[model samples]
Target: MGGSGFLGGELVRRSVMDGRVVAATYLSRPGAAAGADWLPLDVRDRTAVAALIGEFGPDIVVNAAFRQSDWVTTAMGAAHVAVATSENGGRLVHVSSDAVFSGKAVTYTENCVPDPITPYGAAKAAAETAVQAIDPTAVIARTSLIVGDGGSPHEDLVRSLATGGRNGVLFTDDVRCPVHVRDLSAALLELANSDRAGIHHVAGADAVSRYELGCLIARRDGFDPARLPFGRRADTDLPGPVDVRLDCGLTQRHLRTRLRGAREFVK
Candidate 1:
């Protein structure tokens, strides 16, 4: 529903390219993505969500709307969308995050119980629980850090750190499986058109440390890698790093699409 966001924009572009009629929702930032009808939506409002779904009557409702700083919008909003979509008899493909797990395990499968350590992760985990309870058939695709040709939040943070615009230390211990925006978007659309339901791990094939990711991004973007300082979560006196590595084998087996690694697309 977040047509202006990176992933949402990519999905809209791909949907239009495939000649599908697309209607997207935006909040504060108006979406400039072409070939899609845009509408203002406050997903936090249950009545508004139901009304919007009734107006659109979309065969598949994709809830890509999220705000990191706003839990009401990110967590409860997902529940509202799920319940509304379920009542309307529409398939729901809710985009989720890998942060839903604690970094305790080496790798996570779709069946892994959520044990979030961060506030954002907790919110995501709660959203997943609510969605499943309200709509058991909805496809909850939990993905990791998203990157691609078009700049994303992850790339923006890396660029800021690499160029010394933002003074922050990259954690060598924190690891994540980052997926390309286009690849994930295409896979979401495929799932939207299919009957697959339940949780799916849609992420990159490789997992890399945040420190390594910053260095690779710096080298690829013509920035000084030396400017990015590497630090450990333990040394920083912060909570332990949320090192999540998703097992996307099930996703790969279920879909024909191949999600590539960060190293393959950074250049």
Candidate 2:
């Protein structure tokens, strides 16, 4: 689902390239990617979700639709998808987030239980719980910040800051293990086709702060890295994790796709 989104669009593109029959879901408008059936779906509607998945009868379903601030869409919508997928007898791969963890653990493994400090994190945690309960065989892939060539929100922010289009400071204390969208999409497909069940951590190899990440993007995009203003997350009243990193060691050992770090990919 969410074929119009950045990560979702990549998934649809790759799946179509592989000659798979694809049916991608969007909210408002269809994505630019061709060769896939673009269907309008509001995951918040349980009946609509069930009807669509039932009619499609896909062998594998990947739920990537979410709104960070909407509990109904992020948490309850996931549950709806899980239920529908389970009833349709299809393999499910639900995308989750690292926000489920507080920075108290610093680095988290697949075994780590979610202790979210923010509303978004709590919603993600709730989604994970519901998916696991509904479909024990489902693959719940928890990924970190998803960066792409020049399409991701972070990349856009970097360009805006560097070109004086926006005013903001990249947080030096806010650290995360960001994964490339292509790598993450490929990994999700691999897991979807495999028998891998339960939670899996799919993230980049390197953990860096947001400021460091912005600098890397600036350098790659032909901008002066020094011009990117930086600040400490600790100095702000922001309610989120400071240094949450996902340890993808165990999951990496099982995948053929090499998850590239931000430094290498941006450069």
Candidate 3:
């Protein structure tokens, strides 16, 4: 689902490239990508979710639809998708987030239990729980910050800050392992086709702060890295994790697609 967002758009594009019969879901409007059945869906509606999934009866369903601030969309919406997918007898690949961690451990493995500190994190954690409970055989892939060539939100923020289009400071203390959207989408599709079930950590290899990431992006996009303002997340009362990294070692062993780090991709 959610074939209009950055990561979701990539998934739709790749799936279409692979010559699969794709049916992508969108909320506001249809995505620009062609050759797919773009269906409007609000995952919050349980009846609608069930009806759509049942009608489609896809062999595999990837649940990537979520709203960070909305609990019903992120948490309850996931439960509804899980139930529908389960009833339809389809393999599910639910996209999760690293926000589930509290950053107390700095790094987390696939086995790490979620200890969310923010509302968004808690919602993602709850979504993971609901997906797991409803479909034990489902692949719940927990990824980190998703960076793309020039499409992702982080990349946009870097460009805006560097070009004086926006005012913001990249936090040097806020660290994460950012994975390329293409790599992440390929990995998710690979897992969806495979028998790998349960929680999997799919993230980049390098760990870097937001400021460092912005600098890398700035350099790649022909902007002066020096123009990107920086600060420390610790100085602010931001209710989120400071340094959360997902260890994708175990999950990486089984995948042919390499999860390129932000440092490499942005270069």
Name the better of 2 and 3 by lDDT: 2
lDDT of each: 0.88, 0.96, 0.95
**Clash total of candidate 2:** 0
Error of 2 at 48 (Å): 0.2
- In order of appearance, the predictions have TM-scores of 0.95, 0.99, 0.99
Can you write out model 1's per-residue Cα lDDT over 171-235, one digit (the tens) per residue? Answer: 88889998999989989988988889999999998899888888888898898889998898767
Task: Please give the lDDT score at residue 140 for candidate 2.
Answer: 99
- Model 3 lDDT tens row, 81-136: 99999998999999999999999999999999899999999999999999999999
- Superposed Cα deviation of residue 164, candidate 3 (Å): 0.9
Clashes of each: 0, 0, 0
Q: Local error of candidate 3 at 95, Å?
A: 0.3
Per-residue accuracy of model 2 over 1-267 as CA lDDT, tens digit each: 888999999999999999999999999999989999999999999999999999999999999999998999999999999999999999999999999999998999999999999999999999999999999999999999999999999999999999999999999999999999999999999999999999999999999999999999999999998889999989999899999999999999999999999989988
Residue 236 lDDT in candidate 1: 69
True lDDT of residue 57, candidate 3: 93
Model 1 misses residue 215 by how many Å?
Answer: 1.5
All candidates: CA RMSD (Å): 1.4, 0.6, 0.6
In candidate 2, where is summed lDDT lowest over 10 consecutive residues? 225-234
